[model samples]
Target: MLQIIQRKRMNLTLPRNLHDSLLKHAVFLSVCLPETVRDTFLVDPAVILIVVGVVMFFITFCGCIGALRENIRLLKTVKFSFNTLLFAFLSLMLPQTRSALEKFARKAIVHYRDDLDLQNLMDYIQKEFKCCGWNSYTDWSWNLYFNCTRENPSTERCAVPYSCCTPVPGETVINTMCGFGVQTQKYLDANKSIYPVGCADRAVMWIETHLLLVGALTLGLALPQVRKPRHTCRVCMGGRTSRRHQKGLTACWRSRAPTE
Candidate 1:
């Protein structure tokens, strides 16, 4: 589980038959009858360990090839510093960019159940910020499980995710039902159980308040990217200069008169 958490993305090319075999094995593991092995195969510890092993092997092979070939692009880390800064700046300063972020946040909430990773990320964000959905707690209505429509069959209908709930002191175990039926309540009533402010507003306000820190971090990341190419050029020029000096000395030595 820890190994899988560390891997951001994975793609490996293999023979079609080998790939199909692995896929079939993975499917079998996912549906195994043992309660311990059932359904959660994607995050199973053994599966994660195997994935980590394969990833390590692939990376080691690539590193060896890059080193042998002296491929600067492959040896050095890929720099996205400028693009990252630009996107961050635009998201902070432009209304349209901010709107897009808000919409994305809301969409994540709407499809919260579709991806476990997304659900975990959303939970973390909400818990950290002490905020609810994108616009309001009611924004969760867009999720099928939490839909407020009369026809929705989910037991959690009209409820926000439990991440929105205010923590109660001395509670040993989390009440997963803490946010139950929150969307159905009046604003004042719901506020008692969960955060009232939207996550988008909280995030924006945080950025505004920490503008100096953000700027410092942006500059810190950008400085290395700006300097790296210049440093590489200097090294190459130094090598050329050394070679020219050595050649001049060699020519002078050969041309010098020798006494018998």
Candidate 2:
């Protein structure tokens, strides 16, 4: 009777613990995998901005030094070093679900208007980049206030943003109404009235015009560290230091140690 009771207790306890352990393991796998992959590959917009800034600084420093010295060897070295990165960027394929730049711009504007920061960013980009809407002034047609539809009774109908207009000479205050009703006009008339060309076209033209200059700048950046070196990369991955660079660090520490 005593042996029978002991055996029954053991059987019940083992299954209960095993069931709990399996449940925990299942939860861990489900919660962690997708988050880990997302964080590893697709970075946040703010992080992207920071990375771009750092690269620009690096390019300027390398280009200035190499150009001032007129060092052919250094320039050639940098050019060869950056060839892989340049190729990667040029070959990068981003998703184009919307299929057209005009449609994409309209979708972005309408979808993100409620997000104040995004709205301000779009306005600033248009003003500072000397650009209007995405594909052209007509892209504002997607906006509720600017849609050309007569059935819509908004006061801002058939209008584009003021940033689309050319500024007057010595103008201190901006004329906010300059681009109002410009969208209703034909391209030939609007060309004289306001900026008729789309921001997308402007951006494309800029890229095409400066493609060679961009290539030269990219090569002049001299970031040969971007190469596939396991030791150096590991150091860079964690706060820009590694064991390989720890030489003399130990010496400094020893020198600081108490001595007789």
Candidate 3:
């Protein structure tokens, strides 16, 4: 506290008129931008999460109310909005741009190798699909660890991943060394040694194969809704018949009453 007082005492001061002018300007700013007083606070991770949580809560709350009330118009609006967003996402991910996907795959492997989840996903894709690299095993040449050159001088040079290897029966563990020097070899030898194609071609094939499945699922979802009105129409007709019969019985009893 004593040191703080000494530091303040040593602080330089402007002329009295200049000090007065600066003070007036500060007061003017405070009055003009009163709402920004707390805006100086840094937005940290916790604050970001809280904001996201609140936004999601509001959206979900509105959806729940719409569902319980059976508001078709509101539900349709929400459905259309969500579908539009999904369509946009699918448009971007579609296999139309083969070159773009190939480029993205090359960068994804190199930059995201340290990211465990992405790395695991790539590993699974390679193993499950029995493929390697973006366009071919040579695509690994762009990777620092796998590039076949003296400047880089890596142990993994001219090597594909173990996922590209053909599994030997009765082997509990993978032959990690099976892919070594396979990239530098000819395709005739490499065909027996490793997967010969690129991931982009395989991915395109997978998407093409599953398109009919996606269409079937979509058709299945829509058919139930289309058929729902048929069931409701029968119920509505039954209700009308019952109402008509009730009216006829009351009229018949009134007419049969003797001149009362």
Per-model lDDT: 0.73, 0.65, 0.68
Question: Which consecutive 10 residues in model 2 have the weakest lDDT in total?
Answer: 33-42
C-alpha root-mean-square deviation, each candidate: 17.7, 21.5, 17.3
Model 3 misplaced stretches (Cα beyond 4 Å): 1-62, 69-80, 86-100, 229-260
- Top-down TM-score ranking: 3, 1, 2
Can you write out model 3's per-residue Cα lDDT over 1-260, one digit (the tens) per residue?
A: 99988888768657789887778657643543332213222222244468869856755766787786867776776777677757866787565567666655765555333345555666788888888888887777665566665544457778877777878889998888898998789888888978888888898899899999999999999989875654545444455446665565456545544585
Name the better of 1 and 2 by TM-score.
1
Candidate 2 clashes: the total is 0
List the pairs of residues colliding in candidate 1. none
Please provide TM-scores, in order, for all candidate models, with all chains considered together: 0.54, 0.50, 0.58
Best by lDDT: 1
Displacement of the residue 71 alpha carbon in candidate 3, Å? 7.2
Q: Which stretches of candidate 1 lie over 4 Å from their true place?
A: 1-95, 218-241, 244-260
Give per-residue CA lDDT, model 2, range 68-169, as digits (tens): 686776577567647855776556523442245455465545533444545666677676667778877888877656767765555777888776788788
